[model samples]
Target: MFAMLRYAPLLAIPAFSSVAWAPPMIRMVLLMAVAWLTVIAAPSLTPMPYWSDGGGLLLACSSELLIGMTFGLAIMLPQAGIGMAASVADMQAGLSAASLLDPGGQHEPETLLGSLLLLAAVVLFFTLNLHVQLFHLMAESLRVLPLGAVGLRLDPEAFMAMVGSSFLLGLMVVAPLMIGLFAVDLAVAYATRSMPQANVYFLALPLKIAAALLLLAATLAYVPALIERVFQDALARLPSVFGA
Candidate 1:
């Protein structure tokens, strides 16, 4: 339970187990209760030869915690990709100023285009059962890197590669929209220059939003495929990312 609790937030990223909105005290109590239940239900889940001197137990706990964190982080990379795509699209659409406080207590940009895309991404995530896949990956990780066996054995290069690839996937998802928005920007610029007295900045926002929405609606069919590909790529890299 403790091990799982250490990584619960990571597991919660996909919306299934998130408790970030709860009061801190309530959240802690809930987590502790869950952890206790988990331990009670699965005694073997803990590190072998659990009883030890204080220093040894501390080392064991640290190693297990590290393992949980690594697995959790690896599972979270694809979601980061989703956030990246939304952020860039929001920026280009001039919707960066529109913001919301999410359940995690973070201020997130909230735009029509970005919100739509984020919703699509999340829907596809659940549709593809990637959350289940992540759970399985986490389980597999335990087999490959057992509790208290050692500290995380991540390869820096592999980790960087995963990060780079995830970001690239995000860029790919937003590429077409970006190009369309860029053309819109050029048109707006030319129009503004030709008519110096016009409120072009104000005018551009609506135009950009319209174009982004149109493009998004037109290309909506392709989003599932893009999301699926990114998800699969992330799943494929999970084993290497966690040294599984």
Candidate 2:
């Protein structure tokens, strides 16, 4: 039990960071405590494979920790990639200038699009009951990959596929805004070409901003569906992470 407790922090770190509403420290503590209690009480509620001695017990605990960390990483990687890609897109779109630091992400510059993605992720997790599903999955994984068994193995190809999917999702989410901004730019260019005396840069800036805002407002309705798909994909790919 003490050994499992030591590994609880590893399990908590990724799950806690993924949640947007909870303070980082509080999330971490909550998840760690949950993991600790789950492991400590496992023997009483379920049949645990018997070990011969202290040496066997030590090996079992170490293996459990490794498996927990691997499971946590599988969930965290996609979210981290999505957040990073969203930040890049926001920077390219000139939206990074007015970013606030995000405490959950270690004070990184939190761009508008990044914040939206994070919020969407959080909403989908709760609304779809993904939090409950994820906890159930974690418990099931323990049965399949028991203590003293080999640690869960990640498949590189599948992981890369998920990463690609996450990037594509991010692009799709921001595509409407980009397209609107591009149209505004083209219109401004045409106006400048027809009337060479005009100051196109100054005139186009507000137009671009207004167009972006309008498009964003219009696209708000589709956001819930997009978020649901992303969360579904995240959950669907869980088995692949453990090479299942």
The residue pairs found clashing in candidate 1 are none
Please give, for residues 1-244, the per-residue lDDT of candidate 2 as tens digits: 5334334534444452345345767766776677676666555433345455667666767666666655455456546655776676565455675654444656566788777777676667678786677677766765666545534477878877776776677567667777777777788889999989989877776666566667778998986776566556766777886689
lDDT of 1 by residue, 1-244 (tens): 4445445565433342323445666766765664565445443655456435677667666776665565555545666777777678878987775555344535544555656766676778778887778667655555565545545677777778887887788778878888999999999999999999999989789889889888877877887898788778867886676664
Tell me the alpha-carbon RMSD of every candidate: 4.5, 4.6
- State candidate 2's TM-score: 0.73
Q: Candidate 1 — which residues are off by over 4 angstroms?
A: 1-7, 12-51, 100-109
Going through the candidates in order, what is the number of backbone clashes in each? Answer: 0, 0
Top TM-score model = 1
Q: How much is 26 displaced in model 2, in angstroms?
A: 4.0
